[model samples]
Target: MNFVGYYRLPPVRGVFFSPAQEERLLLLGCQEVFSDRCLAGGVVRSGLDRALTALEPGGVLAVPSLHALAGAMVDLLDVVRRLRALNLDLVVVQPPIDTRSDAGFFEACQILAT
Candidate 1:
């Protein structure tokens, strides 16, 4: 299975966090990295859109944290639902979530519920 890394950072604050996030994803075995540096309030997430569109059904999407993936919980839930529908897995670094195994999937669900 292929692994893709995605992250979103505020435009002016990404100088350090962006590279660190990329390196972490690389260490986690992600082959491709897609990033967005834009205002947090902006509705467009071109990088995330591209990553989702490019990843195949069996591929995985890795992100630093839930916050980096979405601006709000509603959006996060929507993305998670889409990922599930697409048969794509997700690996989150912070809070250590993985949807590849039964226990991990359970843990992810618990986290999402809170």
Candidate 2:
């Protein structure tokens, strides 16, 4: 199984992924990193699409935070559903969520429920 790192910069002016964030993902054993810079009022997430497509069943997707993954609750849920359908795991470094663990999985569900 591979651990792939993904990050996104909001439409604001900033770098793709901060050095420390990339370092953290690397420390967590991520083999590759994918990133996106959101365009103002844009809905396309080509980077996320590529990352998901690159992973096979049982692969892992690591991100710095939930907000970095998606902007809205519905979008987040859709991403979670896709991860489940693809048989992939998720690891969020900040706020520390790991769907691979029972407690973390429950926490994820709770977060989504709210």
Candidate 3:
């Protein structure tokens, strides 16, 4: 088989604060399986649980970029931040290094490369 033929597992998403907002995020989200409080309920925890269940193990959770970091952030990096804030374990892709010190960036890249 050609190396190009390979595909990766899917990403999952969740919403808990607002319905319309959540739906919109899902529709516009770069990842698969978006959950909004409108469709899932009013609980953010429930939305998170649902999204987690739908996610494949070791898959990444994607989210919108923060207003502050928008210009310097990537779609995948934003998701990783949200996941970390929510206390989820995910493989953060293309994470930003501006927040890091010079030593930190060097260490992180070394770890990432491995």
TM-scores for all candidates? 0.80, 0.82, 0.30
lDDT of 2 by residue, 8-89 (tens): 7777665555677778778989887777788888647787888898888989999999988888888888888788789888
**Candidate 1 Cα errors over 4 Å, as ranges:** 13-17, 103-114
Model 3 TM-score, all chains together: 0.30
* Per-residue C-alpha lDDT of model 3 across residues 40-74, encoded as one tens digit per residue: 22223344455655555434443332321122235
* lDDT, model 2: 0.80
| Stretches of model 2 off by over 4 angstroms after superposition | 14-17, 103-114
| Minimal lDDT window, size 10, model 3 | 1-10
Q: TM-score of the candidate numbered 2? A: 0.82
The total of clashing pairs for model 3 equals: 2
Q: Kindly give the number of clashing pairs for every candidate.
A: 0, 0, 2
lDDT for 101 (candidate 1): 59
Compose the digit string of candidate 1's lDDT tens values, residues 1-114: 478999888768636347788998899998888887766457567788788888899889999988888777777877887787787889889988888854466356558867
CA lDDT of each prediction against the hidden true structure: 0.80, 0.80, 0.35
Question: Which number leads on TM-score?
Answer: 2
- Give the clashing pairs for model 3: 15-35, 63-79
